[model samples]
Target: VREEAISRSRCFLNSAMAFTLYTYPNNYRAIKSLIAAEYTGLEIVVPDEFKFPGDVRSEAFKAKSPVQKVPVLETPDGCLFESNAILRHVARYRPEANLYGGPFYEQGLVDQWLDFSAFELEPPRNVWLYPILGYMKYDKRAAGKARNDVEKALTVLEDHLLLRTFIVGERITLADIALGSALIAPFEKVFDAKFREKFTNVTRWFTTLINQPEWKAIVPSVSLCEKEQIPAFPKKKEKQPKQQKQKQQKSQAKKADDESAPPPKKKEKNPLDLLPKSEMDLDTTKRTFSNNPFPAALKIFYDAWDPEGFCLYTSSYNYNSENTVDYQTSNLVSGWLQRLDSLRKYAFGCVNVWGVEDSKGPFVINAAWVFRGPSVPFEFTDCPDSEYHQLASVDLKDEAQKAKFEALLGGAEKYDGQPLYERKQFK
Candidate 1:
């Protein structure tokens, strides 16, 4: 019966379906989906004059998505919106490939990180990079705020890349794809030589990722230029006070130390350890479960328990009992999990599980919990499970929560002694 169903549903490659990517060349979100499609081996059709505010409101584009967003993937399956969602769909059809990953848990991780890229990193970068570079009209106050925000975000990334080659698991995944696309704007316009030099790890990771064959296929080459000389501020006519000079030197030394300090070690217990021990308490009331645990429950927990100071959105795809896992999906998932780890310093609290599967007979996940911290991002498994009940305890900078979490899971020694992921904290 499974074979028959698979045969019936097989999608034959006809003339590559018209996938209209409605975007300007410089739009970060648009480029992300476009590049993802390219890496996944999907053909993309770019439309002329479909740029910015014009494309966002065009009636022709609105037919694809009510909001008229760029990167609306028009497939034989029908129109899909959201750049990340579009990338997922395009990649899903080619699961055998390594671009995504090999397991259901991995795919979930990819989805999670892609959501992070859209939520946590892109907004401020766009605010500063776009206007500053002439991609859009400039707003001085907004641009300044954006620059500050981006610097903080970049610091987090800088710390994470210090230990790993890629964002997730072991190789490039959707996490890298999404982040690379988001970074394109700033790397090209706002992050000049000095800025890149300051974030050494980020510079190294980005340089390697973008140079990969897959990335180069879609993203245009970014020009790296020598630092331009800035005119010196006119010297004050009066001599500077000796006290002020000393203070300035002290401040500069402190800044250097702050940038060079290693990330804090992960504490043993975290707030997630406080949840009720019963499995029943973790299960979702809304979904029916088979005798076995449902896969969606894991997703609910991961999505909800995002301590990583970032919001996570669930994917539209329903968890299926018969779903086949592949390397591409797994890669994407792993990338997301790694990205989540990288942001752990900014997260707090535990995520809870609701259920998994749909109402017919199998169980489905419905609810979750997330704890956030002022400066940390959330953390999760590098490789997740589509089946089996799993719970993760993450610390987003709360010592008490970390202690509790460690107690629940035996001891801090059992888990990686170091914070699973480390990122720079910006004051």
Candidate 2:
């Protein structure tokens, strides 16, 4: 009781210090802020809105994050974007928090790896990963080059980790935070058993980071890709007329390609200037016009911001994933959408397949949606709890509303999971 009271008092004296990080999860870029907050003991809040479209692209959001990139830190001093900048800001938030390395030379080491993590690791990692996750079109030639690039970065780290427990000195530094987060997707999606066996030192270092309490606080699960995935479809053997068989084969192949692809590109520019001046400030407005036109790709990629009347929710197959049979997982999505008949008026979403259906081991269900009411009813989120591994609304909305509305409508293009399962529309 005494300790609780003292902690409350300490918080009170700090001017109600609170931070709202604007971005989505399982995002490596956002991890630096989340991990830094743990070390600094800073109170940070991520607006439930990230699950939707528009938060980062909105006029108000752009006002703070001019470049419109995420993991933006909303601080009392003002807004700070760029993941590295946020990491630096929070690491220095409480001088007592020794996240930034000590001594001039130690700091240089931290900066060195920070650069290596962002430049050396992140680019190739994204090229290698985004294609697999459907975030980008899978161009075999490009992906091959990307894999080679990633191997080069991993080689650098293997030599470094061979000597140190952490990426830097005695404690976890910005280097570990940055590099660890960047590695998550690649590890989960591509680095398989044989790959890890070859990089023994890198494996040891990864295990150390994954086990840290601070690391687990943000990332609950870290699984290595048991095998590398290839998204193309296999040949069919069923008997049919030659023309019919060829047509069927082509259709199925095209379908698989569509469901397994991600958004085409990143729209870094904010399309709007002053969102139509409303007497009401940003928090309450319903309609916001973009300063310029939103390309379909932009609408698809940047479409999500938390939308009013909506909450983002994700679900995964609840049963033993080991029991999964190829297209059976996609059929599960088909069934879920069929079951979501009642939500037509209130929801718009897409069901994504993270890995290739026949070869991709497990399938997770994702939906970025909005409700007709302030919240999603328990019936939708909790009733059939056992049927889903997860179901929760994270938020997004408006220039205020236009962007959110378009984003919800655009999920089909963004996730574009139609080819994986039969695309269903309740509306």
Candidate achieving the largest TM-score: 2
Which lDDT value does model 2 have at 122?
A: 72
Model 1, residue 35: C-alpha shift (Å): 1.9
Cα RMSDs of all predictions? 20.2, 18.5
Write down the TM-score of every candidate: 0.48, 0.54
TM-score of model number 1 = 0.48
TM-score of model number 2: 0.54
RMSD of 1: 20.2
| Candidate 2 residue-wise lDDT, 204-282, digit = tens | 8888888888788888789888988665544797779999989999999999887977768986532222223323222
- Global lDDT of model 1: 0.53
Q: In lDDT terms, which candidate is top?
A: 2
